[model samples]
Target: MEKGKVVVLEDRVPKLKERRRQKANRRLIAYLSFFFLFILCVLYFQSPLGAVGHVEVSGNRHLTAERIISLSGITKRTSFWKVNEQNVEEKLTRHPEIKEATVEKQLPNTIAIHVREWRRIAYVYDRQTFFPLLENGRLLKQEGTKTAPSDAPVLVGWKDGDAIAEMTGQLAELPAAVLGAMSEIHYKPTREYEDRVIVYMNDGYEVSATIRQFADKLSHYPAIVAALDRNVKGVIHLEVGSYFVPYSPPKKEDGDETTSP
Candidate 1:
């Protein structure tokens, strides 16, 4: 080998070692800085600066704020850095009535949790027991469960849990006047469609509709009723478009024609 080549080769080893040493030093400094920051965090969290002094909850209706906070295990004494948001969220979500929960930190000592609760739209009857079904498609306790809203529709013969989706959808599309006039809903599980709903109106009339077409048809009930003579009696047929036929009295009559409502 030439002398210059030999000298260059000899010089490269120390330079490589020095570079590795510098890299190692940088890594050590990073670790030390992280450790120091971690220590400071621990101290700060423990020193009342991170203690939860204020807790706020919003968007909760069915669930009480205190009950939700208790379930979350985040209290006034909870350390801000030590707060387990995921755990709190999971705990809040354990109740099927809760649709969603979001936890947010307000400041050094404040935590806010927003929760959306599932609203019960209808009640399902399994035999004689009536179980209230939430909008998210969960059945509440049947035996001695809390009373649902007085205006909520009572569902008869509907056990398929998926019916909740249709019920919610129909309710969403219905105008408030027609919706408030509804007294009962009978979910007839027909071979054609399980979502068929037979409604009993407060006006002593029955409505035939599938959940698919209920909202649209019900919304137009006012116009349909307006066209009909109120003196005539019959259930308003809405399964298709608006049609009103006179109610036939329970007797065998040959030529008797009833007036249309």
Candidate 2:
């Protein structure tokens, strides 16, 4: 009706048809993709392919694989996709011996659980029965059949609970070599220091140290022993300062220890 204006259905027909065809093709492609995805999900979930078939436990010493796996609550019936990693790990760390735990899912329907148990820093005696003192300062009663007798320090005359706890804490900080060298630790509270302790070394030597800064001072034990004359073994006093006091040859008092000179 207006000047220089024209409406022709034939001219626009091909363009409109082409656009509609392209849109239909996109819709068909989307439907096919969704259909194939649904099929895959159904096959995976409906059959035993997606279920956990095996469990692997590692990094455990005091605890067995079966025990750790049981604690993690992971069984063959547990769904691979439904297994919550965080939940299983938290469950494993609930035990007193377990210090850390991690959960990982492996390929081909397998779940892996990794754990780290606390170290046995020392031992204390209760009515002649030996108990392991953990790095966390907890006492655990177990058979001494597994112990080599020289594995850790034996705490004697440790009547005070707090003293034993502090001693365990100190022993845990020592290096493996230093801790292994110690055989016995007797609680001998002196007038000046209540935390005074007498340590008997495996190398036929004695050490006088207080509970405070015990680990720091004891770290130089290997060097101190190395510098001292091995032929002349006496007492390595670490309470006030690092010095070697040779045992006096004159034995006159009844208070002398059988082991000390």
Candidate 3:
């Protein structure tokens, strides 16, 4: 019985040693894996691989790509992990010409910026220069040019601030074709018609209209002009009702119908 007990104790010693060996192997593998991951993370952040390599800009017109990128405050040296998309977008939108802006990050090394710029619809003459007016009724002094814009109508005599605002709003609602047909708009308010305006058309006809129903009535201008005799030059009254009054030719003096050459 003493010999058998000694044999059993001897067998248990090897089994315990094997178990210890297996545990140490697992620990070694765990340590190696952790170190490998740490090294990779350090390399990724410290190397040029994590730097912004490319910047793409889209949907920009009045503002150039370089200008948009400059406004965004992002550079090629910026780290991919450190880019703040919301902050960049806010900075880009601060430009008066940019209506909307979006910034996005592409994995590994690229930044993309998209922007929408304001549309220049017309120009208002001020201090002998024409300043660009946006579709939203905002005027941009920087967009001013020394010469009048050929494609847009020139606003004249609408000096009152409120009247100018109202006129701009009305102009915004008119179709591009209708607006293009007009050469100039002059404010000619009367006691009976306080909102009256005189519009000189590119087609050589004059229009009398009130601001209250300016856009609504001017939409019918093409039809009204088409119904009239094209050879006759006249004033189209769109205030009380739409009608045409032909300009009277010069009359002969002292019953003489013949003219001197």
Candidate 4:
């Protein structure tokens, strides 16, 4: 009986040793896996994969994509994790033409810049140069050799403050066709109408309007001009109501008709 009990004990010892060996192997593997993962994370952060790989810009006009990107101060060397989206957006919006801006980052490295530029509605002429009037009623000084845009009418006879602001606001509300049809605008205030303005149109018609209801009345310009004789050119008064007076040619004596040479 004693010999059988000892034999059973000896068999259990080898089984216990095998179990311990298996547990140690599992621990070794876990340690090795943790070490390998730590090394991988370090390599990833140091590699180009962590850097900005692509940059895309959208919703930009009047300012080029390269200009916007340059203003953002973001480059390929910029770390994707370190990018401050708000800072980039603020930097971009600092430009005079940019109205709003947004910056976003994508994982595994991509950045996107979205910008909204102020719409240029007209030009204000000063000192023989044309400055752009934006939709928000701010004027932008002309740069380089850029001339007045043909799409917008030239604002003449306006000093700086409230008159220019009022005119630009009115111009912004007009339809694109009406705005484009205008060639020049002169502030011709009269005793009866202190806010009156004379608009010289590209179609060879002139408009007399008050700033109080300028856009509302001028919107009907096309229809009014359409009703007139094509050969007639004169002022169309829009302050009280719409009317046209044809320019009268100079009178000639009966004998003034020249004989054939």
Best by lDDT: 2
- Per-residue accuracy of model 4 over 65-135 as CA lDDT, tens digit each: 88888999988888888899999988988888899998988776889999998887888888878888899
Better of 1 and 4 by lDDT: 4
Model 3, runs deviating above 4 Å: 1-34, 150-152, 176-183, 190-192, 200-206, 221-236, 244-261
In order of lDDT, best first, we have 2, 4, 3, 1
- Regions of candidate 2 where Cα sits further than 4 Å from its true position: 1-43, 141-151, 245-261
lDDT of 2 by residue, 23-128 (tens): 9999999999999999999999877888899998889876789989889887777789899999998999898888999899888788988899898788786676
Ranking by TM-score, best first? Answer: 4, 2, 3, 1
Better of 1 and 2 by lDDT: 2
Worst 10 residues of 4 by lDDT: 142-151
Model 4 TM-score, all chains together:
0.77
Which tens-of-lDDT digit does each residue in 1-261 have in candidate 1?
Answer: 876566666778999999999999999999999999999988887787778888899998766888888888987778876787788888899977888899887776788899988766666666556676676556787332344445466776666556756677677566667777777888785787656778887777788788887777788887887787676668787766667767774564798887889
- What lDDT score belongs to each candidate, Candidate 1 first? 0.76, 0.87, 0.85, 0.85
Clashes of each: 0, 0, 0, 0
Off by over 4 Å in 1: 1-44, 47-50, 126-130, 142-148, 159-181, 188-196, 202-205, 222-234, 245-261
Best by TM-score: 4
